[model samples]
Target: MYLSQVKSNGKQYIYLCVYVGTQEYSTRKEKRVYSFGETKKALIKMKRWKRKFNEFPNELLNLGCGMENLEEWIRTIETGITKTGRIFKTNVKRAVF
Candidate 1:
């Protein structure tokens, strides 16, 4: 189910305070929502969300790999999901796709 989704910087992020699953999913267990953005920007947004809910956003994301769906699809090329609960910016090329 979708709720008050953020339209910031062409990415949609769901927050605990603004998300409430639909009726079909009676139980609103805010879980992995997908989003996209630069690492710094995403973390800033996450920090804001944590400030409001006192909790972290356990989101499922493409890690901001290039947006494509071919054999080189950005979404499909990422290594895997990470659950880091802190903000970090890196100059390492390997870290970013």
Candidate 2:
């Protein structure tokens, strides 16, 4: 997601461009643009979108700070193993048992 500014007929406008993956095999990507007219509301929306995308998740494997919640983490692993009937690779440096 990104923001773009455009000028038309002496009026400047802000646009939010979101890259959406296409379902069809022929087209790999598509752009979804949302126009927020030059107004205070547009600024607020842009800030909100910027905040949301700035914290986007890049990977699912790493749980940096969440490692502190040992019990919940253990439960999650156990539940996943039970449901999938397979063991997942974990980077557990120490084990109580």
Candidate 3:
């Protein structure tokens, strides 16, 4: 899944897109849902949604890499500080969750 931007009627909007079908079979079609305005905010929202729903593609999870990769993905989306006030940085986006 990825973020898509579209322009229509002189207005630009961002949306979240996911491919249709399961890991074994793909219809080669995309389903776009959830429109947002700003790119950064949209990304943040999408990351939160993805994490909350465990929206990672089944193909990736089924690759035998298993939960290790899944945990890595989650780590990338989450960033904050511990009780010691030390910052935890991730190579991926800095999400609030």
Instruction: Compute each candidate's TM-score over C-alphas.
Output: 0.25, 0.30, 0.32
Q: Rate residue 7 of model 1 by lDDT.
A: 47
In order, the Cα lDDT scores of the candidates are 0.33, 0.40, 0.48
Candidate 2, poorest ten consecutive residues by summed lDDT: 60-69
lDDT digits (tens) for residues 1-97 of candidate 2: 4334456686555554456777566473545345555433444433444455443223211323222222332432333332335543232223223
Please give me the total number of clashing residue pairs in predicted model 3: 0
Q: Residue 45 lDDT in model 1?
A: 47
Q: After superposition, how far is residue 95 of candidate 2 from its true place, in Å?
A: 55
Task: Give the TM-score (vs. native) of candidate 3.
Answer: 0.32
lDDT, candidate 3, 48-70, per-residue tens: 54566466445444534344433
Pick the lDDT winner. 3
Q: How many angstroms is residue 13 displaced in model 2 relative to the true structure, after the best TM-score fit?
A: 0.4
| Each model's Cα RMSD | 13.3, 18.3, 11.3
- State how far residue 11 of model 3 sits from its true place (Å): 1.6
Model 1 spans > 4 angstroms off: 1-33, 54-97
